[model samples]
Target: MDKIHLTFSQKIIVNVFRQVRIIKGNLVHQKYFFILKHEMQLSEFKYMIHDLGPYSYDLSGDVEYLLQNDILQKYDGQISVGNNILDKVDDIDLEEDEIEKKIAHISSFIQQLFDRTLVSEKNIELAGSILILLWDQEIYVKSEIWEKIKKWKPGFFSLIEFDSVWDILYHKKLISKEVYIPNNYIERLKCLNSGSKNAREYYRLIEKFFRYIFKNELNNFVLKEYWCDGNKKIDFSAENVAKKGIFKKMSKYSSSPINTIPILCKNQDRELFGSDLVESYELLNYEFSNIAFLTIRSFEHDQWILDEMTRFYRENDKKSIKKILFLLQDIDLIDMVEFRLRGIEPSGILKEKLRSVITNRNVVPCS
Candidate 1:
């Protein structure tokens, strides 16, 4: 028989099924495995950042073509290589001189991950998520990178134990060796939050704020300029589910959990303490998030703000998710970035302030 014709994406998909029979394989699995092409630049398909990580219609279309034409097949929710797998893989062997070495390396790695029961949508997506940020030159710190990935896919990572999977990928070298070290963090923060003129940029930097300071504690969605029915502008907001972090402990022990965290960014340093309290408190919808976060540089060591924090806590009132104002500051924006860059968890800083807040004492300064 003559050689079979295949599209670039078709050959790449075939190569994956050839090496391993992926159980529960589907489009998500296919797209993530296809990220292999992105790593080695094997395919020409371009992907946009989807909520589920990178996605490409070109790749999706080619997958449909291959399956419809029987170049690839899926049976019993198990995806394996087809009988006529890519005319011996020559078309996607990448460079003939390289002689399929890249695919070979990938197949071996996938097989190893499969053997160790590490191949899954989340694990592969984790690696791909890291690659995406590295490519954008957004972050290089491991802990910080992990935080950002969790923020992107919170619902997925929330219930899974993925630390072991990450160690294998990073410590064992599946991540690219060419690493980027960020140098503009301090200056970046200064420029973004310096004046009301840059408040828009500061709103954008709020995502950076969560990844840096919160460090996987809160899974946030940036909603700059989000408007309410009452027409008040919400500078930012986040998923109120506290991960297995300081906030989690607060939820478990204190029962004062927030539904959605509303964060507001300001231009000049003001004693934001309680200024927005009655407004934010009145703003809470009974069916939705019941708490708020106001951005401040430092918790002004005032007895009134201290009193405002304690006033909201009702030991027996589970319905009282409101008035739990968690104040974040500017120093944390810089300090936590450095902390996570060195692969440190910024939870200690959080714990310090939270402890003081819950105890209704003067909050510890972020150092």
Candidate 2:
């Protein structure tokens, strides 16, 4: 069997605090308390390994330790626990009862912390639910940032706490009970951790979260329509003709000239530079009357392309050559926004945007 390789992000997580484990036959000895006791210099630990790189592993046993330490607890009976029979020096068969018992205990601990955890909706949308849960909870206090929140919600701490909550909820073994804590607790908890200034950062995080979701949705929308799947282009087209020159001359005889719409879709974290829109311009320049630029941010068309487009529009007044640009901010396509000019221009709200742009066009420009 081939060994599965973790991504660059996974390696950093495995080494975050390393580990101290001793397994004896069926007995497992993951002495988490001992590790924390030896490495409890939280501030030093964070500073020493400040940059954890990209991917991080979920320190499962760490949460177990947190629950055992009583810092957090779960809702009643959400998870089950079992007797610590393996802790003794008895040689025993692996029975279902024993397995369930161990899982119950572990699950109970995990669920308790899961219930008590606080996550920001923003971090959940950005870093993803996984990172949010895997983030070490001690960072807030260890960095002296905890004192910064003047006002807070009941359960969650500062902004970062929301990230932790997101991770936990993301992969919780028991998803049914992973309840979302209301904003009230989030707001109150913000004040308690870091004071007024810290609270503001938390507030901003929440705001950014809404923005991110909206942007993410919009990006997804444009991608769904324009992104290429396999070798087939998103809006693939080809024309058949008897003789190229004769067809061109005879086709010029149509009462209504055929217009193609070239669409280019770019989904990137960085800005969409002017060069990214070149291909779209070329495809639609002559055969098409309009080009649509789709991206999460502004579509910066090259100067030459811009100049050509301006000239084309200036010359083709009757044909109405135009460029339509769709830029989504920190919002997802699920939300509604003004986009009437670019065809039917349905924001994130409906599939109508797809119908409007593709229905009457001779060409479709896609990423």
* Top-scoring candidate (lDDT): 1
| Candidate 1, 340-364: lDDT as tens digits | 6656777677667556556764444
TM-score result, candidate 2: 0.26
Off by over 4 Å in 2: 1-151, 154-156, 173-279, 286-291, 294-315, 320-367
Q: All candidates' TM-scores? A: 0.43, 0.26
What's the CA error at residue 312 for candidate 1, in Å? 43
Q: Give model 2's clash tally.
A: 50
In model 1, the runs with Cα more than 4 Å from the true position are: 1-4, 21-24, 31-35, 84-97, 114-120, 141-155, 159-162, 176-367
Worst 10 residues of 2 by lDDT: 20-29
lDDT of 2 by residue, 1-367 (tens): 3333332222222222121111111101112221221233222122111121122123334334433533223344221122332242132232345433443355334323323343222322222222222243222111122232212223334546644543454355322211222222233333333333343343334333223323322221211223233422232222322232322332354344433323333333355455444455554554453334332322344344334434433443454323332233223232222222122223333233323332423332332
Query: How much is the lDDT of residue 249 in candidate 1?
Result: 55
Top candidate when judged by TM-score against the true structure: 1
With a 3 Å backbone cut-off (N, CA, C), the pairs that clash in candidate 1 are none
Error of 1 at 304 (Å): 21
